[model samples]
Target: MQALTWWRNPGTKDLDAIVCDGSVRAGKTVIMSLSYVLWSMTDFDAQQFGLAGKTIGSLRRNVIRPLKIMLHSRGFHVKDHRSDNMLEVSKRGKVNYYFLFGGKDEGSQDLVQGLTAAGFFFDEVALMPESFVKQATARVSVEGGKLWFNCNPAGPYHWFKLEWIDKLKEKRALRIHFTMQDNPSLSPSTIARYERLYSGVFYKRFILGLWVLADGVVYDNWAAETMTTHIDDVSGYESYYVSCDYGTRNPTVFLLWGRKDKVWYCLREFYYSGRESSNNWDDSQYVTAMGKFVGTIKASIIVDPSAASFITALRKAGYQVIAADNDVINGIREVQNAMNNGKIMFADDLKHMFAEFSSYIWDDKAADKGIDKVVKDHDHVMDALRYFVFMVIYKQRTATTAKKPVWLR
Candidate 1:
């Protein structure tokens, strides 16, 4: 509310911009949109304005739809221009014009150019291209006009955080950070559900509402006390799955998972790191080790897609092996989601897997080179974990739980 006042009544303070950064489902968007509309209508009559989102669909879903409902409930006469996709609002003999635009990509800047808006509102500004934001800001050249922005936090180095919000001078801008707690309408269960939806960078940005760097430790949610446990019994499990990453020189990792009552527990791991070995181990050695480890347990085996030799070897040894989904980003996301939701627990004996999780990090060079990837070092066990989560657990859970499952190749 104070942040809204900083824009609604910017008396001697002379502020022209308001930024609200926060967690999802916070009351920031609705309240700020209401305030922006009402204040604009009161301050400037018959003025041209603009509202933008990542896309037209999102703009309508996030802002225009709810805003129209709010306006009608308050007895304001709202007229739509279907041809231009705009709205002309009038109340108590006063009128204002609002144009809707999308900044879905960097190329979207051309659409917002040449407009002279009295003010503008940007939804999910952090997800927008920097060029589009600059173009939109330039369009709002009207005197005494302010810019309104609301977004979930991104990396600390994200342009919106580094340039506009962080460098903001007194009176020039009012920046407010919000969390799920700020919204009274959200129930405790709803908040917890949201918290479970993200992990690692997404957790930091979308849950905690912090602008932290997405650099090190891929699974930052892992802690020995909370996530790792010792379980001597597997009799309660309804089924089991095994995931393996076949590596000769790098490492070979096989993780055993047991599921009971919707919870997946990491029961054991058979790891072989050849970092210090003079001779690279053969596929037969891993196959022999795996056969001994399982000891007649009937579990569906998922193996690395690239390891045809290992796959053939496993099948020859009387084990059913399905090729694991190796889509790196999506796989990582599934594993992280499992960890975030407390659906996955690791056995205390899987020390190597824990060590790999701690060292896995985003590849800065690859990011700069226009590719999103994680560092491939010491990630053998991590890869196996990702494969299990992405292929089996996530697929099953989302099929039943989500409205539309996020499918990965």
Candidate 2:
């Protein structure tokens, strides 16, 4: 019944799958695992179920073991859930469950080597490589079988998330999101701990399930094509604007957004890893780099609220900076509008951004309450981009840029 709430009012629709990211207290993993089973039930399949994670040990302990206790306690007839590193459920002697383990280990690929699957779980998804997940999914021969992944946002860089979650987002892949508040059973202490541990973008992504941009974010949607190495100049029919996802120790992210006809395009991004060369040197160097990259594209440069310091420095350094409005949901609304309207595109250099677009998701707990983009971890670039788009690019301060009222993506 609860899963239906999220399914009915998800942030992004057309989902064949979902991703639930939440704080430690949030039952993201539990919700996803149950959703896997719930979705499986709606599909009306008693076929074998599989669960795997970063290692055989983890799979056994985390996925298989706990799931067993959960099912058993819930009156589920789990015929066999053992530390033998296997889990199985049965109704009337028909085996319906089989939990297993896997990872980047070459041998992990062999776990699925010979078996046909109805569906499977890939836990700790952020830790696994994209190659490993791909190989495992390919091995699923059960028609219409789903491959589900659950993980907390772990790093500024990860390949699987970039490809599956991030890329699919731009192309508009099916997905769902969640956060700790979604689960009513969590203790307050856990929530408080997570709140204390993360802040700003990090907190938003992991705890809130917001799809903001991170330092490693790569996508310049304003480019001629999503991923072109071509040096040809791209023309546009609309004005241009820039959105910056500010970071200090992390890489500073800059995206140059442009509007053409009715679409929003990200032409290029300026991402810097190393520290500024001179202490006196304002970050304008990045802005300068972005200026050269965009050339004469006449558009205002919009930045996130976090960039207040950066913007101040830029202004002191004599650079023009237009701060992005950064209205959480409103920004996401604009991006969704551009995407659903088929008016968004990416530049070649924006690969990372593209990846984030696909991989980013919402916090399901928030979705259940009809709150979209609840700031789960893993997809910050997407969040930052949304702010840049709606709050700044899509809105004309001179004219009201009204968007759809609150709705889950």
Candidate 3:
């Protein structure tokens, strides 16, 4: 409530910016966005402003849709120019232009260049590159221009934390921290369900809303007794999938997965080390071996994005192939969450994957430099598992429709 009235409050009117950082589903984005729009429409007119997110699609989905509804309820005229990626808003014969931008990468700085903005609102600012944020902020040259930032907590050494968040007083910015408790709409049971979705570093950052380093074992929740199931116990599988990590000189791995009753089971695995074997298979050879390994099972195959040759071979051999999403840190978090929530399990016979889990520790050297990276050794099966859980299961969990596999169709 204070954050919403900061601009009107005499004591905080002089602040140049507002930063809201907290847990997921903590009601930060909606409030921050509402406050920004109200502040703009009330204090400024016939001017230009900026609304940004990590990507334009996300900005539209997360902010624009709900924001438009809120404005319409209050009798404001809103016009969205999709091709131009801009919004025209007016009320009481007062009009303003709000341009949308995506600060996804270093190149995103160029998109915000050459435009003068009266103010800037960044959603999930922590996910954007520093260059893009700097460029966007620089565009706010209007005399009374202010900044608004909202995001979940990331690493302790993130650039945003060091510059904007840690220096709130120096930057003359108001900072508001929130948790699930702050959101009145969420019930105790709903909050508890979300709380059970994460563990380890992800739990500290996303659930507790703390800026902490990711260290130690990546999947600390993995235990043979609890996380593994015997193959005989798995039945009624509705869909099957194969996730692969292809390597020429290093080890290659393939993990077979099956879904039953909203839970995924790693039913089987195939691991081959080119360096350790007498025969190093080519792309076609690996494809042949994979076909034999997956014999008679109609399943969609998810392969590493970088394996062009292997992907081609698999596709030519009549396999439906999907290029896996390779966002390492996020993928690891999704995999860990799946394990923690009991959405995924491993078959007891998959010894290689179980062995790899014990060695899949966070890179301490990288952590020391404020980066979250997993150790590269003994990670083939681990990578395959991550691919399956993140790309297949995570999407299935969030998607409104559970589409059947091509083979099933």
Candidate 4:
């Protein structure tokens, strides 16, 4: 209502645009859409308005559905034309029209190229291409028309943050920030669930509503509390695989992976360090520990390509061992992508693995030199993870008989 009140009197509020940004599902979209559509009824008569999102599908889901519900309650009937992607609202012999445009890519600039709208509402504006945003902004040439935008915060250097959002001035624009707390309907448990789903840069931006940089962490997608679970029951898994990273002075880490429904779970982990072990473990002793780790289980053991001695020992012990694919950048990308898509999970017992993920950083010198490399310190478990993802999981992805996987080649 405050936003509506501000928009109600153009004489009092001279802002040309209002940008609402913050956490996800925070009632920002609902308020903005209701206010924009309702204000357009009295503010502009018998004219077409604009509605945009990353895509037409998203606009329908995020803006059209809820707005229709609100309009219906207010004695208005709304009609959506799916064929042409347009919306029509009618109430007591009055009607307003809206055209949907998708701002998903740079080419989207042409999608709204010639539109002259009374006003516009853009959802998730941060994800839209700058070219499309600028082009769409120019199309709202009607007098008293304003652009309304709501989005979650992105990287500090995101174009939206760098451009119009940061240039807010009195009467020129209104900038409002929201958090999950803004929505009283959201339960505490729901909020806590969202809190556990993001970590590092994601937490800073989505949960805390800050425009932060994404330079430090490599596996920025991991959330230990949410993605890690106890793997006491493994009957659900169709198969299992193991990957190892052997080090004498550093930590020798082994990761056990279980698969179900195309999703991979790091079920358990075994860590042994020559320095940490009181007996000063050798390859044979570590191999004995590895044997106990996967006792009486049908599993493939993938070993580090460099660990020739360990591989020979594992093979001699009647275990199936294969040389792991060690393509560093591709392996990192495979793991990162899996994490981003919520496809990789870890068991809660893998404390060392969790700690490695939490502290893993990109190689600063390599990054500065335009090379993507991770800092090779305390990354024993991470290396094991990469080998598993790249050699085992990625190979499975490509072996499918249907259309080839997009990530394959």
User: Which candidate number maximizes lDDT?
Assistant: 3
lDDT of 4 by residue, 43-69 (tens): 777888899989887787678777777
Best of the two (2, 4) by TM-score: 4
The better candidate by lDDT, 1 or 2, is 1
Top TM-score model: 3
List where candidate 1 sits over 4 angstroms from the true fold. 10-13, 77-85, 93-95, 186-208, 223-260, 264-337, 345-355, 363-373, 376-409
Candidate 4, position 370, lDDT: 33
Alpha carbon lDDT of each predicted model: 0.83, 0.59, 0.88, 0.81
C-alpha RMSD for every candidate? 7.0, 18.6, 4.1, 10.5
Model 2 TM-score is 0.45
lDDT of 3 at 333: 84
Model 2 backbone overlap count: 62
Pick by lDDT: 1 or 4, better one: 1
Model 1 Cα lDDT, one tens digit per residue, 150-247: 99876666788777887778437778889999998999999999888887777777789987666767777777888888889755588899999988
Sorted by TM-score (best first), the order is 3, 1, 4, 2
In order of appearance, the predictions have TM-scores of 0.64, 0.45, 0.95, 0.63
